[model samples]
Target: MKILKINEEISIKRSVDNGTEEQRVVVKSIIERVRQDGDEALKAFTEKFDGISLVNIAVTEEEKREAYKEIDDDLLAIIQEAASNIRSFHEKQLHPSWMTTDENGTILGQKVTPLDSVGLYVPGGTAAYPSSVLMNVLPAKVAGVERIVITSPPDKKTGKLPAAVLVAAQEAGAEEIYKVGGAQAIAALAYGTETIAPVDKITGPGNIFVALAKREVFGDVDIDMIAGPSEIAVLADDTARPDEVAADLLSQAEHDIFACSVLVTPSEALAKAVAAEVEKQLLTLPRQNIASQSIENFGAIYVTDTMEEAIDTINRLAPEHLEIVTDNPMELLGKIRHAGAIFIGRNSPEPVGDYFAGPNHVLPTNGTARFSSPLNVEDFQKKSSIVFYSEKALKENGEKIAAFARLEGLEAHARAIEIRLRK
Candidate 1:
């Protein structure tokens, strides 16, 4: 694949960054109809979309315990370690409910509480993503979500979920498992059926159908960000290794044919070297075609005038994953105002965030990082601001409060406070 030349003055538009245009709509409509029609609609979609018979949507207790033994100890250990790292990182993010009493005898603060029930979608189709299983459940578990329900499609060939996925879910503390996928699974999670209970919120990554379903079901249940194709941007200098940067770019590109992998560097020589390294690495990757298409269509090397210029260009992109492989990445951290997550140094690759690293892999994409954030403990929990007033407190500020309410034409609100003060 030829390296696309990016001009320093221009921001290159990815040929494939078409945002939320696909199956999100069709998936959404299917989910709604399934919510209304229940088993009938769900089975039809399951058969049509997934090509699976659906007599039982919920995984049985016996089947779950059996899945544990089916997976070997080595893979199990990896899942356990990943879960531990994820748990430890999210534990630091926990917030406690706090209250304060002011001079006027008024109490005000916020109560941080976890959701009662959360639904996690573990994408299962051609391949199983145990990493996604870890990503979705770990945050909710850390947030103290009471009941975590997991759903993934059964394997088309084996007619069962991959051993790695089931084991990962078990390690992550999912309370229940469902044998469903695509838009139908989303519908069941949102509306509940005889077998599956409705959850308070749904979180995870899926195809365009799942993304669209999440978009359509937003008000009915809380959702994480509408995820796009995985993306990574490596900001490197002449000091950075060309081979490593090329490998990192391909890592995200292989995620999907549309995934965007980019490199922005101040050194033209380094850019050329990395571009050559990308070609060398692609020959060895199993998903070479997918990664090649992604890089050829959406990838590029932007030669900036300086490191400062490179950082400015990256901030505008707000990529899902950002890696700074310059000499001293720490000094450049504050300069980076955007990015869903930042990895500094040559050793800190994007996959570190994907698995063993404590930070979440599920992140905002397509420049949404400027406004949104990676899935964290906070996403599975909510905060309600607390307010309380004593008779003395109300009397102290009653007139002002009443005047403000009156200005807004809320006579009842003014009367309520005024009546309390009068007493």
Candidate 2:
């Protein structure tokens, strides 16, 4: 980690990966093939990319039973507990369709409707993320989505989705699971194949190809944001532990080489200590190579003149994950205007939110926290603006509406209002 003085011009923005031209072309072609050939295209792509032949694209009940067996009792229990926590949290976010009537007999409100179906794309390769399975599915489940489907690549050796992922999906109340991944999986989700029905929205994280595929099919079907690499920024003071901060930073760093880990603090000594501790801890991480590359490329420690300045720097960066570790972290909470998720105090580490804690871990990345938000129950639901115009109300306001429409040069809109007024 490089230590530097915080300046007004300081920025932590990384270039968003919109994918190369070649990758975009490939994704466009894949989506087209899936649209045309449907299930066969999915199978062919699975065999070509995942290197496995699938007699069935869907995960069978027997396969799910086997997956349950592979998970130990303790781990299964933990997954269930995590699912319960996530469900309980998201259920609080559910809002009922509401309306209000005026004295003139006009009714207006929002009608909240859960999506008919949703597809969660879980990444599978070097690691298994049952946590992501819970994070993505449980929110949709809480939003009252009828069909919550999961699509993850099967392991090359066993030709099955990770046992933990399967178990987590089941615990999260999602029964529809598919064994497909990459751009092909995205395409299958967007355009219904013979086996997999198309969903109203798609959510989850994946590789560059998957991101590109989501981008390609965005307008046809709603998608969660095009996520970038992971990021974490810790705003700490001298009271914070250097080793603990370093470990928390490394947690995001190990996710990818492009992952960003930064520490902003007023204490120069604390900054130096954390930088040294990060180096010391890097040697022990199993994903040391990935973490090291991430640290070398994107990690930094900034020494600010005051805690206020540090908070300002953090807001400017709008990091995905922010940890406020200071003498009084709560006092600074209201000052933080950005960040996808804020973990206050030393005890509330980022991992707690990532796994056990109720908050959704699917967060906006690459400085998108300034405008976007975390994946939550709201993402799985849509709102329809309810408008019931009574004859008396329209008679009172129709001329004003018509004049407003005429001012916009939309005669048809004016006529529509005038026609209603005449009725």
Best by lDDT: 2
Taking the tens digit of each residue's C-alpha lDDT, what string does model 1 give over 274-333?
989999999999999999999888888888888888889898889999999999999999
- Over 4 Å off in model 1, which ranges? 1-25
Quickly count the clashes in candidate 1.
1
Q: Per-residue lDDT tens digits of candidate 2, residues 255-310?
A: 98999999999999999899999999998899999999999999999999998889
Please state the error at residue 109 of candidate 2 in Å. 1.3
* CA lDDT of each prediction against the hidden true structure: 0.85, 0.92
Q: Report the C-alpha displacement of residue 29, candidate 1, in angstroms.
A: 3.8
Q: In candidate 1, what residue range of length 10 has the lowest lDDT sum?
A: 10-19
Q: List the residue pairs that clash in candidate 1.
A: 24-212
Stretches off by above 4 angstroms in model 2 are: 420-423
Evaluated at residue 245, the lDDT of candidate 2 is 95
